[model samples]
Target chain A: MIAALMTKKEWITNNVRRKNLGAHVLGVTAFAGGHIAVHWLMPSGQVVQDNWDMHGLEFPSLTVELPEMAWDEREIHDVFGYRPQGHPDLRALVRNPRWPDEFYPMAGLNAPQKPPWREVAPNNPEQTVEGEGVTIMKVGPTHAGIIESGHFVFSIIGENILHLDLHLFQNHRGVEGQLQGRLIGSVAPLISRICGADTVSHQTNLAMAVEEMAGYQVPDEIKWQRILLLESERILSHLNDLAQIPAGVGFSVANQKALTMKERWQRGLTVIFGHRLLFDTVHPGKSLAMDTAALGALITQLQREWRPWRSLVQGHHGFQDRMKGVGMVRQSDALRFGGQGVVARASGLTFDARQLMPLYHGWHVDYASETSGDVSGRFKVRLDEVEASWRLMQGVLQRYQIHSALPFWEPPTDLIGQAATFSESPHGLNAHIVAVDRGKVIRYHVRSGTFRNWPLLSKAVAGNAVGDFPLINKSFELCYSCLDR
Target chain B: MGKSIQVLQLRHVDAGSCNGCEQELTALGNRFYDMQHSGIDVVASPRHADGLVVTGPVTDTMKRPLMQDWDAVPEPKWLIALGDCAAGCGVFQGAYACYSGVASVRPPDLVIMGCPPLPQDILRQITVWRKTLD
Candidate 1:
C-alpha cells in the first residue's frame, strides 16, 4: 500500500512537471508506520496534498516525488551526498554523515543510498604564545539581569576580550514543530508561552493568523481592545527594562521608582483585564470581556499615573548617563539583519507592521523611531513607543465608544487553503502562516519578532568588551525559548 | 577607597521548577522591595559573589553544576535557601530528576519558607544577612 501511494504521487508529480504546473506531495500513515508524515511544497502556492498508506512497517518513512528532468542532482549530492543511481550528475558529491535527513526525510528505495564516510583531514594548528596570566571566563545559560540563557566563552587578556564565542540554546522549547496540525484556536496559548515578557505580542500574531485563516474580520471595538492590551504590554516591558538598567548600575532609587511604576501598570492590567500580563485576554473567535466605559476609566487612570512617572524617569541625569551610549547598534546592522521592535527602531530602521500592513484595514496608529543605537536609543524608542501606544489606546477607546456595533467574521469552512496574518506585537511585527483543512490548522508557521532579532543580537555583542556583555544583552532582550522553538 | 562589603552571588540550579521562587527573587529588585537599595545585588558569576541564593528543588543533572557553582564562589560566602522548593524540594520532590533542595547539594546558612516568599520576605532575609556581615 505504501509503495502504491508513492507510485501514484510520483505519477502525479511527473504529469504536473510536463505541464510546468507546481505540485505538493504529502504522506500520512497510521500505527505501524510509526506515524511518520511528509509535507512537500512546490514553487507555486498550494496546500500540502497527502498520500496515505496503511502498511505494517517497523519504522516510519515518507517520500516526496521530484521530476527527474527538473531535479538538481548535483545540489542534492552537495547537501545530502546521496546520488540517485540513475541520476544525471553523480560526480560532484561530498559524502558526509552530518547531512540533514531528519528535517527532509525521503524514501530509501527511490532515493540515492548514503555514500561512504570521508576521513576528517587535520589542518595545521595555529601556534599560540604562552601567556603567564590568561583566564577563561565562562558566563551563560544562567545569569544576572533580564537576559536569556546562552554560554559566552571569553578568553580574556587582563580584562580585554581577546576571543569570544557565544553558545546559546539553554531554553529550547521546540514550539514551531509543535504547532503542526494544532487547531487554530489552540495555538494562542502556545504563542503566549513563547516569551513571558512578550506574551501578548506572540498571541496577537497567532490570533491574527487564525482570523485570517477563518476570513474572520475582528470587531472594531475588539481591535481597539487589542491595541490597548498591546500598549499595556509595551508599558510593562519597557518599565521592567528601565528598572533593570538602573539596578545593573547600582542606582537603587531609580530602580525602585521604575519597579514601582511597573507594578502599578501591572496592577492596573489586573484590575481592568483580570490578569496582570493580559494572558489569554484577546483570542481567536472571542470578544474582549471588558466594557467600553470600564476601558475608558482604566485609560484615564493610567494617564494620570503614568505621566508623572515618565517625566521623573526621563529627567534623571544619573539614569541617562548610565543608559546613553552604553550599547550602540548601528542602522546598517539593524537593516541587514532585520532587527525588530525597539531594537530596530532605536537604530533608525522604521519598520512597524501596524503602520506598514494594518490588519484591520482602516485603523490609523502613531509610530515613532530613534537614531541612536545605544542603550539610550533603546530607552528612547521604548519610551516613545509607550507614549504612542497610550495615544493609540485612547484613540481606540474613543472609537469603541462611538462605534456601537463592531463586525465579527467567522472562518471559511474550506479544506486545503493557506492564510497569512501580521500583527504589531510588543516585541515587533509578528507574522504567522496558517495552512488549514476544513477549519483545523494542518500546519502553522510562526515567524516571531524575536526570531528575526537573534542574529542581530549576536552581531551586536561582537567587538564590545566583556564587561558590557550583560548590558548589551539586556538592551537587545531577545527571547530564548521563542527563538529556540 | 573606604571599607566596602564584597558581594559574591551563587545562582542555584534545578532540573525543573515552577519558577515561582525565581519570580520572588526577581521581585527583590523591583520598586516594592528594592534589594539593590539595601546594597544587595544578584551577581551572574559565582566567583565574585558573596552569597548563594538557592531556589527550587535539586535535580540529578543540576547536582554537578550546582555544586560547581557553589565551589566556584569564594569562601566566607553565605548560602540562602529560598522558597519551599529550596527548603524541602516542595512539590517536585518525588519527580524524576528532582532530588531534594539546597541541602542535597550544599549546607545553607539560611532557609526561608513559602511556595515563594514575597519581596518583603526576601528583603527581611537580606537585612539579616547584612546584620550577620557586620
Candidate 2:
C-alpha cells in the first residue's frame, strides 16, 4: 500500500496511541525533497508507511514515546537541516564541525553564504560516574584489530563497567548523498560497498526493491538462483562470525580452523564470480556471471566440510567458559530497542525476515532462537542459522539439473517510482528504501541490521569487564561500514 | 636484498575503509595463509610496531588519529597502503568527510591495489618482501 502523508501532530497522536492501527515504527528516513517518511513494521511483518511534510525546518518529534527514533531523527537533522522539535539530544551525527553545521550535504541547495571550516570541540558526553573509584576509558575510531572506526567510552569502577557510550559515524562517507540523483542502474556498486562483508545481501535487497518499483517479475530459474546466492552469502557470513568468537577468546586453533573454512568459502566465490567479496555480483534485474558446475561443487564441498568444524568449535570447554554468561542482553531490553538478527534471536525474539517477509520465494526456513540472552546464546543462534543456510544451499544443488538452462533478467526501460524492501541479512533485518523519478534515483536510505543492534551493545556491556568487551563485541559481529554508511 | 628485516611487525589503521581490506587481512592470518609462518605479525599497539598497514581514504575526522598512529611507530618503519581506497580513495573519492587517499598525509612505501586485494595477493606481496632479505 502507498504511504499517506499526515501533518506532524496528527501522525504522532494517531500512531503513538496505536489508534485503530496496530503498528510499530519500523524506521524513519528523510529525503532531499524536504520530507520524512516513517515506516511501521507491523506485527505480521508487513510495512505500513506514512510521511510527515515539514513545511519549515522544524517538526514535532516522535522520540518521546519511541526512544529508537532518536537516531533516526538526529540523522535527518544532520543531513537535511530538518529539526525534530523536542528531541532529547540532537547533536551532529554523521557530520562534524569540519564540514560546517550549516552545510547539509543532501540538502542539495545552491551555493550560499558560509563560514570557513574549523574543528569543533568534541561533542562527546562528559563522564557522569560520581563514585570515588570510578574511571573513564576510551577506545577506537582506530582500534587494535582490522576494524572500522567507532568510539566506545566506558565508565567503570575497577573491572565492572558502570556505563558505556557508543560514538559511531566516524567513517561516514556521505554514501546516501552520493546516491541521490544517480541513475538507478549505477548505484548497485555503491550499495555493495556500503558493507563489503555483506555485499550480496545489500545488492540482493536493492535489486528486489528496484524490481518491485519497476514492476519486473524475475523468471523462476533466476529466482531460484538468487535464493542460492542469498543462502550462500548467509552461510559464509555466519561462519565468519562464528570464527570471531573463538578468536576473541584467544583460541587460535579454533579461530584458525573456522577462518580457514570462511576463506575456502570465499575462494569458491572468487573462482565463480571473479571477486572474493562478490563486488557488483548482483545488480538490478540481473545476476553476475556464474558457472553452474563450479557453484555445484562449491555447495557440495561446504555441505560436507561445515558439520565437523562446527562440532569442533562448539565442543570446546574453554571457548564455552569465556562465552557462556558474558555480555548478557536482557530479552526485554532487546525488544524495547528494536534489536534484530543475532542480538534479537539470542534474546529469544524469533523475527527473521526470511520467514516473515515474502522475499524468500515461498521457502520456509526454520530459524533458531535462545532465551539465554548471553554471548553463548548468540553463538548458538549463529550455528543454527549456518546449518539452516547449508540445508537451503544443499536443497538448491539437489534440484539443479545438468542439462537445464537458466535465463537472467534484463532491466526495463522507463522505470520510475519508489520501493522499500527488507531481507534477513546475516547481522539481522536489512532495509533498503529508494525513490525513483525519470529512471534516476532521487533518494536512497539503508537501515542496516548493524544500526538496529548497535544500541544493544552498550546495554549488554553494562556490567562486563573491559577485557570481556572484545568477546562480547565480536559475538554480535556488526559491520561498521554498514552502520557508518 | 640482504638488508631487509626478517620479521615485519605491523599495525592496521582503518582511516575510512569499507572494511573489505580488513576481512582480507583477517584471512591472511587464517590457516590457508598463516602470516605468522612468514614472521609477519599484526600487533595491537603502534608503539611496538615497525610499520602501519593502512586501509580506506583518510577521512577528515580520522586524519589526526591516523597521523598520530603513523608517528607512534619508531624510525625505519614503513607505511603500506592497502586497497584502492587507501591508494586513490576508491569510491569515496572527493567526499567531504575524507582527505581522498593516504598519500595526502604521507607517501606510502608500498601500495597494494584492489577494491580489496585478495588474501593470497596480500600474503604474496609480504612473501616477496621477505624474499628480498635473502
Candidate 3:
C-alpha cells in the first residue's frame, strides 16, 4: 500500500495555514539534489526544515505566499535560475550588473567562463518611476565616504523621498561558490572575513554548524568563552555604528568619543584574544588561556569609558534632536515586512535568536526589546544592547574563572552530515546552514540579518527628508558584503 | 623651520573588500594614529585626492567604477593597494567575479600587507610613502 505524496507547495501552504501563528520564515535556498529548502522557526525554539523537490524542471518556480519569502525566493531565482512565480520584482539581487545572462554560477557543477571585463556594468533597463516634480537621484556604486560600494536610486520631490531602491552585490566575490569542496576545518578564516564588524559572530555561527556536523558537544567552560567573544563583538559593532551616527549629523565631537571607545576595546581584544576583531578565536578544541587580571581590567576600563559616553550621547540635545522623529517605521509596517534583530526589536516585534540557542539557557536576561522604530529608537536599542552585552561578558568571565581547569571537548573527526543553525549577530539574527560529505563542505547557505532587514531600510527612507538619508542609513548600518555573500 | 609643505591627500576606495581593511582604514583618522597630523588626509572625492588607496580583490562589478575614480583624479596620482586581498587577492585570488587584486587591475605604487594590516601598519606604510612626494 503506497501513501499519497502531496506537492511541495501544498505542504508549505498547509503548514502555513495550520500553524498557530507561531511560525516564522527563517530563509529559503536552492541546493543540489535537495532542490529548495524552506527553514522555519517555531514558537518553542524548534527549527523545522522542509525539503521541497523541483519535479525535474531546472528553472522551477516555487511561489511563496508570505511576503517576507519574496527576498529569499528572488535570491534563488538570481543565482540558481529558479524562478519564484509569485515574486513581483525579481530584478537581479545577487546577480549584479556585469553578471552575464543565462549564467547561473551555483546551479551547475562547472562554473561559466569569465566574461570580458567592461568599463561599465550598467543596470540594463533600470527601474524608474516618472511623475511631475519627481526627481531621480543616484547616490553611488562608490559613495562619498569610505563605505563599501553599493548604489542607491532615490525618487524624490524636493527634499522628500517617494521611493528608495538600491543596487547591492557590487562586491560579490562568489563566497558560497568558492566554499564548495573545501575542508570544513579550513573554512574559518574565510568565514571570518564575510563581514568585519561581526567577524566573531560569523565564525562562531559557522563553528556551531560544523561542530554539529562533526557531532561535537562543546564543553560548558568553552561555550561560555565563545559567548563572551560574541558579546564583545556586539559591543564593538554597536560602537562602530554609534560613531557613524554622529558623523552623519556632523557631530564630530560625539563621533570621536565613540571612536575612542571602539578603538580602545578593539586594541584590548588583541591583547586578550590575540586578534583585534576576535577573528582568531575560531577553533574550540584548544584551550585559550586569557589572563584573568587583564580581562577584569579591560572590562573595568570599558565600563568606565562607556558610561560617560552613553550619558553624553543620551543627553546631547543637538544629537538627540537630529535623530528623533526621523526614519520611522511603523509597527504595522515592521510586522508586515518581517524584520529581525535590532530593527524588528526597535519596531516592537520581539523575537531574539538567543532564546532558541541552548548555550544561552540558565541565564536570566531580558529578551524583550521594544521601541518606536525610528533612528532614535534604534539608537536606544543599540545602547541598551551594548550595556547588556558587557554584563553578559562579565558573567561569562566569572563562570570561566570558576571552571578554569575543566577538560575541553574534542571535536570528533569521524561523524558527518548537515545542520541548519541560528545565532544572534550584532546586526540581528544570523543563520548558517551547512552540509558535509567526505571531509569536505558540499553545501553552504547563509541567511544574514541584513538580507531580510535591507528592504525595511528602503521602507523607512520613504516619505523621509532626503538629507536625513545618511542618519537613517547609519541607524540601520547594514552590511552590503554580508548580504552579497 | 616648522612645516611649510602641503599635506598629501589620498581618497580611500573600497574595490570589493570584506570590510576588514575598512576598519583599519577608518582608525587612521582617530586620535591615536592621527593621520591628519602626519600631513595625510582621506578626502571625500577622487578629484581632491593625490592617490587612490584601494582595497579588496577588485570584483568585476566594481572594476569600472574604480577605473572611473582613477580617471577623476589628476595626473601623477599614485595607487596604493592596502591589504592582502588588494595586494595579491589573498584567498579571493582567481575567484570568478574578481580580477585577482588591484595589481591585476593596475599595478599599485604602494602595497600594505596582512589579512587586514593593522591600523598602525597601514599608517606606517603611508607615512613612508609620504616621504616620496619630495
Candidate 4:
C-alpha cells in the first residue's frame, strides 16, 4: 500500500516536471507534508518507488541517471535487492566479501546468514610478523601510560620495531545506535559521552543542532557562555594532551608540571562550574547561569595562576627535545585527511571552525598556526590554544551581562526552510543538519570534528617505528567513540 | 623525603558500560583536577607497580583477569575503588557475570563516591592516599 502511494506520487511528480513546472514545488510540498516519494527504475524494466519521510529538509532529494550495462556487471544485485543501473565501484561497497552468492539476492536486502567476519583480528598484521629474532610486544587497549586505550601490536626486531598496527575500539559504547528515536533533548547526554574530554563541545554542537531545527534563537549572553564553556573544554583537553607528550617520552618532570597546571585549571572549573570536568553545564536553550562579575574575577585568578606554570613547562629543554621532530604529520597529509583543531592547525591548516565560520555575533577570536607538523609543533599549537582560550574567556567574562530570559531556544518546525547550525568544539567544526517535517526531526546528522581526523592516526603511524605510536597517538588525540558513533 | 609512587590501573571489566565511570577516570589528569602532577599516573600494565585504581564492577569474563592483575601488581601498593560501580557494583550489579564491586576481588584502601566522582574528588582521594603512605 505504501509502495503504491509512493508510485502514484512519483508519477505525478514526473508528469509535472515533464510539463515544464518546477520539480522543487512538488519536492517542497512533499517535504513540508512529511514524506517524499523516491522513484527508481528496477532492473526488470519496472519502476519501483519508496516513500521516505522528510524530517529534515537539509539535503535535497537526488535522482541519478545510470547506464544499464553497468548494472548487471557489478554485483549490486547480490548485496542489495535493487541495483543502480550504473555505479562506479561495484565491488567496493559490500560489508562481507566472503558471503556466498545465495546470501545477498539484491541490493538493500537482508543476507541469508551473517558472515564470520572478525570485529578485531586478534593476530592482526600489527601484532606479529616473520623476521629473525623478532618478538611480539603487546601494548594495550589498556596501558600503563597517561593516554587512552588503543592496543599496539609491535613486532620488535631487538628493541627496533619492524611492524606496528594500532588496535582500537575497546571503548566503543554504541552512542549512535542509542540515539535512534530519542528526542533532541534526550540525546545531549549521549552525544557528550562520545568523547569525555570534549563534553562541552559535543553538547554545544548537539544544542546548536536542536536549536536550529526547533527554530530557537539563543540570546547573545547564552552564546558567549557557550563559547566560554567550549574554550574551557579546549584548554583542559590541550593541557592533558600537552602533559602526555612529555610523559610518553619518559620525561617525568615536564609530565608532572603539566599535570599540576592541569589540576589548577580543573580546580578553577570545579569552583565555578560545580564540577571539575564541566559536565551538564550547557544544555539546549539554557544559558549558563553564573554571575558575570564573579566569573570575571575567577578568570583573572586563573590567568595569574596559569602563567608561571605554563612558562615552566614551555621552558624545559628535556621536554622540548622529546617532542621536537617526533611523530611529524606533514601539512599535506593533514589536509588530505581533513584533520582539525590543534593537530591540523599545527600542520599549517588555518581551518579553525570558529574563525572559518563565526557562530557568536560580535565576538572576535585570534589564533596561531604552525607548519612544523611535528610533536613539538602540535604541543606548541595546544599551548598557544590554551593561552588563547584563556584570553577568550576573559574577554567573554568582561562582555557578559545578566539577562532576564534564558538563552534556551527550540528548533523550528518548518520543513521548506534551510537552517545550518555550527559550533567550534575543542576538537574542530561540529555541524548539525536538521530538516523538520511539521514539528518532528525528519533527519538529524552530526558531523563531529573527531570523525574527520581519526583515520590520520593510522596514516601518521605507517612508516614511523613502534616507539613513536604513543607520541603519534597523543599528537592527533582523536576520540574513537566520537568517530565510531 | 616523599616516597616515589607509581599508579597501576586495573580493568575490573564491565562488559558493556554507559562509560560514565570511564570518563571520570579519564578526567583525573585534566586541567581542573590534575592527578599526574601529584604523583598519580594511570599506568597501562598491571606489572608496572604501585596502586590499583579500579573502575566498574567485575564481570564473569573479567573476573579471572581482574584477579590475575590484582595479584600482578607488587605488594604494599594501594587499591582504590573508583566510581559507584567499583564501590557497590552500581547499575550492573545484577548482570550475569558481575557479582560485586572491587571488594569482590580485593579490599579497597579508598572508595570514591558518585556515579563517577568529579576530577577534584578523585584528586582529593589520591592526595589523602599519598598522605597515608607518608
**Model number with the top TM-score:** 3
Candidate 2 docking category?
medium
Backbone clashes in each candidate structure, one number apiece? 7, 0, 0, 34
TM-score of every candidate: 0.64, 0.93, 0.95, 0.68
List residue ranges in candidate 1 displaced over 4 A: A1-136, A145-147, A155-164, A291-313, A402-416, A438-442, B1-25, B33-134
Candidate 2, residues A276-366, lDDT tens digits: the string is 7778777666655567778878877876777787778778888888888899999888877778888999998887778756656567577
Give per-residue CA lDDT, model 4, range A91-210, as digits (tens): 322222333444432221111223333333222224368867978887654445433444567776765666665554443322332332334445555565555567787677667666
Docking class of 3: medium
User: Which runs in model 3 stand beyond 4 Å of their true positions?
Assistant: A1-4, A15-20, A58-64, A110-120, A402-415, B1-5
How close is candidate 4 at the interface, in terms of C-alpha RMSD after superposing the true interface residues? 7.7
Chain B of candidate 1 versus the native chain B: what TM-score?
Answer: 0.86
Q: Which ten residues in a row are the worst by lDDT in model 2 chain A?
A: A108-117
Q: Residues B4-111, candidate 4, lDDT per residue (tens digit)?
A: 544434433332233456656665655545556676666656766576676655533334445656787776666778777678745444432344678877788889
Model 3 over residues B1-134: C-alpha lDDT tens digits?
Answer: 13334777888788889888888889888899998898888888998888799989998888888998998998768899989999985777656777788988788999998988998888788888767766
DockQ of 3: 0.64
- TM-score ranking from best to worst? 3, 2, 4, 1
Model 2: runs farther than 4 Å from truth? A1-9, A17-26, A109-116, A119-123, A126-128, A401-409, B1-4, B129-134
Q: Where is model 3 chain A poorest over a 10-residue stretch in terms of lDDT?
A: A57-66
For model 2 the local lDDT of residue A224 reads 65
Clashing pairs in 2: none
DockQ of each: 0.14, 0.57, 0.64, 0.17
